[model samples]
Target: MLDKLRREFTLITFGLSGVVLLIALVMTFVSNVTMQNNVTLSLLNRGLEVGHALNPQMGSKDREGTVGADSMLTVSVDVTPSGIVLNKSESPVGLDEDALDEIVAKAVSGSETSGTNWARHLAWAKKSTVYGLRIAICDTYSRDVSLIRQGISGVIIFLMSLCALYAVSRALANRSIKPVSEAWDAQRRFISDASHELKTPLAVILANVQILQRSKDMSAEDMRWVGRTADEAEHMKGLVEDLLTLARADEAKAGSVGAAGPMVELDLSEIVDECALEFDAVAFERGCTISCETEPEVMVTGDKQQLERVMNTLVDNATKYAAKDSEVKLSARRDGKKAHVTVNNKGAVIDAEDLAHLFDRFYRTDKARSREETGGFGLGLAIAKSIVDAHGGKIWATSDAASGTTFHVTL
Candidate 1:
């Protein structure tokens, strides 16, 4: 239970963390782009300020003068052959070639000097005359710095959120499932205790009943009642035994030695054949025929009694549920290292929905028929599955509406 809870908690935490990280990454990317745009706008404004200041300094003879007060700016008054060249302080270059050209054009057009603080540029015309200005303007945000910041912050936040989510999810899962685990344990204990308590008295009652039934003085009617009582007691005994079997199987308990109990290594084909022969008598009484097809000398290592019980349970189920005079086909085959045993019967088709759960404990395909003919508590398949499972095997069932149902066991 704890393992299951922990697994689910881990999955939930990781799943949520993945989603959060993806969103954070996208948001960070957008924010980075926006920030870069803002930075570009700032650079443009400084350029325009330079251009504006240079505009007043431009002259026909000297060509240039100081634009700003700080060492960040230097105005070289140069009269070149074609024009006056004025360069502004170092500024971030525009992102693309087009933006670069636009910045230069803005400076040359005197837009930077006359424009707002958002943009800046250096302007040059002829050698005798040129002006520069710094202006503020609007443009798209730059992406570089914002993206890097967002990436770093997103990674940090995602890691922290994952840790927090995992811790909280684990705690929540434990709390949410604790009650179920407790109830399961309690139920298991109650069944174990109750089954234990009932065994001794049931043994005593069976002993006394048997002793009484053997007496010669009893009337025929009384004998019949005693016989019925014995049969009912045996049935009850079987039910309790099944309960114990399932309980042990579920709890993964080892089996104890007993007379008429399973213990042996034997040829599975022979066992299957014997089970089919034995069921032939009962099947005949029910107007059902039993037959088997098996590979020769297929062997297995397990409890003989339990294996017999498994086969009998399958045959009994087939005979009980199959239509009148329907054939119950028992088959066994060796495929490489494993053995497969299947019982296919012609009968009313099982519903597709029910097939998935047919092997569940106390599950019945036909509840009314189960009550009438077999008086079954729906434990035959469950017990068979338990026995097969104890022997490290598997069991499953399949049904088709046009055909019938086939139950298969692999060992």
Candidate 2:
């Protein structure tokens, strides 16, 4: 039972129930204390009123009214050698004789009758009726005590009932969220299995296509179809690879974030320069100029290969889409404890709405142009994002009518 209640939903319910129970207990205690104090004060005032009526100047022995004739049932009369005393009965049992004597003596001596319990200090003076007043301390005190005990017991019962209700609510909430959890697990497993399943067949096809392309006697028409088929196969292969990479990145982040066990120190500036040099030929083929403005020594702790992939994707995107002969700048530097890498290009402005969705898998700005112009499945930035995320980095794109588009990566 304890273990079951330790689950997230149950624990939340238990916490809420505890809070409600605490509020109830506080209110009950405060209200009971206030009521008891008020009743004690009212009894004291009544005793003082009776003393006043009996003797306006309380020190003298004088009786102004008969006790029973005063029309107050609780009032009592006492005749003594010193005075005709009027006092209220402390209870139906009347006053304690010794306590009455002390009270009478105090009243004659010109002192107020004051004591701890309400019934103990009975007020009296010599009046026409010899009437005095007091309230029963035991009855008032016992009733207040009983009420407080009953209130506590009621609170306990209410808390127990709330706890049971909370248990039921928690179970219902868990059942409602269970489907989302199951679907999430199923989706993760499907991606993991599908990526593994597709790789071997893709490798075999690529191998066979390469062998066929080398044949000396193949017709031009046949070569064209073969090339198209091989390209499509490779695109599919890259998609599967990207999916696997995203899956792995998710697993790594979930399990090992902040542990930094697999991280290594590497010079980001050197890696960016190396990739720029390698992509120079491709840039030249596309009639584009690739330039690097690198800070000499920017060190970062991450997976070197993944960081290399991030640089490669940004360069490839620039090469594919940037206008002919337009400058594509790759820059890297150290900013505080973080390394910043930026790829800027003078190209057609990317749409603001499309920019947000650009890093989503298989998403593209212009899907028709993407399909026809670049032979891209639109997973490059998505893969780059996954890789950067695995290294605890952020990547975003900004564009305007004036400056074209720039993708900034901060690690």
TM-score of each: 0.65, 0.57
- Cα-based lDDT for every prediction: 0.67, 0.70
lDDT of 1 by residue, 1-411 (tens): 346666777687668777877786777677666765555554444434344233322231122433332212222232222223344333232334454345445445542233322333332221123342222333322233345566788778778877887777777777777787788767766876788888898999899999999999999999999998888888888888888877766566323323224556779999889989988988889888988999998888788888888988888889877889889999999977898999999988888888887878778766656444666778888878878878888899888866588999888
Which numbered prediction scores highest in TM-score against the true structure?
1
Name model 2 segments beyond 4 Å from true.
Answer: 1-177, 214-218, 254-262
Worst 10 residues of 1 by lDDT: 70-79
Candidate 2 per-residue C-alpha lDDT over 1-411 given as tens digits, one digit per residue, 9 for 90 to 100: 122433766767767877777787778777877876566555444434444244223233335333331123123334343544543333343446676566555544544444443455332333223333232221244545677687878777877878687878678667766776667557767896899999999999999999999998999999999999998998888789878877666556546333223578899999999999999999999889999999998998887777888899999998877898899999999889898999988888988899889999878898667565776777788878877776778999999878888999999
The model with the greatest lDDT is 2
Global fold similarity of model 1 (TM-score): 0.65
